[model samples]
Target chain A: NAGVTQTPKFQVLKTGQSMTLQCAQDMNHEYMSWYRQDPGMGLRLIHYSVGAGITDQGEVPNGYNVSRLNKREFSLRLESAAPSQTSVYFCASSAGGTGVSYEQYFGPGTRLTVT
Target chain B: LAKTTQPISMDSYEGQEVNITCSHNNIATNDYITWYQQFPSQGPRFIIQGYKTKVTNEVASLFIPADRKSSTLSLPRVSLSDTAVYYCLVGPDYGGATNKLIFGTGTLLAVQP
Candidate 1:
């Protein structure tokens, strides 16, 4: 059902360039999250949204911004991309906003490389 | 959030059962242990979750000890496609406060051909 979809599966940007990574879920989940995976670092959260119009900062929100305009979309934007921003970005959604044991469903991922 | 610790890697032959354990000594009373599997370049997918005892799904089984301090994910009759990184997560998950999963170096499972 294309549970979660991310746009621009791969991208390359020069330093100071700006770009947006889009995420959407057809599962109608209440919570959505953004994370970046770097070599040996595992995955770190970038930002999240509890519901439409409700957004919050995650462990690694620097150099990035997020918006939750509607129930189906949560997008991540890099204002001015840096070399450190190069990594594989993922988006996730969960029905767990209401329960204690909610499990997250993830998007395929967006691999971004900044030179 | 309770911090989690797991192995760096594991290896097993096809048709064998593989058990990967994770330790979360600081786990709170309300925290739950969850597991996810990830192939390279893909997002981690949820495998199973449990508060205590054992919970089994079609893909894997999760066993949480009585003390709630650790948990194990057991894959039965694993095949080549089962080779991936496994992550164990422990958190309160109250009001989405624990939404960000802080991943350690996940166990890289390599199933022999």
Candidate 2:
């Protein structure tokens, strides 16, 4: 099903530069999320969307913004990159329902380095 | 969100059984314990999950005691490929329309030949 896929597997940016990481899922999931993983740390949520056109902030939302324009696409944008943002970014999607718990499918992840 | 505590690293030999335990003393009644496995340079993958007692899947088994304050992930006959970071997560069992998962530092399991 191709599950979930992320774009720009690797990126390097100068401080204050802006970029966007793209995520797409073919599973027809209602929920999508963005997370960042630093060295020797667990993945932390950056932002999430309940559905198309409904976005919300997550645990680590600062310096990051997200938009879910359609059901299959969720994009994360960094307005101004900082050194702290240098980490691996992952995208996940889940089929949310009334009685179902969250079972997420993650993408390969994008490695970003902000100098 | 309930916080999870696990060992930073564990080492075992191939063909041996490895059991990694996690503690979530503050886990709420509605929260479920889930485990994820992640290889280097890859995203985390769901392994097993349970609320209480025992749950077994093809990949691994999740054992939760009566109190549910702690849980263990048992890997049978481990192999080098099974060496990875294991994350224990606690989240609402039925969050309904707004379910989100939080992850903590996972235990790194190294399987040697």
Candidate chain B TM-scores, in order? 0.94, 0.95
lDDT (Cα, 0-100) at A69 in candidate 1: 97
Candidate 2 residue pairs that clash: none
lDDT of 1 by residue, A2-93 (tens): 89999999999999999999999999899999989998778888888889999988888889999999999999999999999999999989
Q: Model 1: runs farther than 4 Å from truth?
A: A98-100
User: Each prediction's TM-score against the native?
Assistant: 0.95, 0.96
For each of the candidates, give the backbone clash count. 0, 0
TM-score, chain A only, candidate 1, equals 0.95
- Please give, as one word, the docking class of candidate 1: medium
Tens-digit lDDT string for candidate 1 (B1-113):
78888999999999999999999999998888888899987898888888899999999999988898889999999999999999898877576645457778889999998
lDDT of 1: 0.88
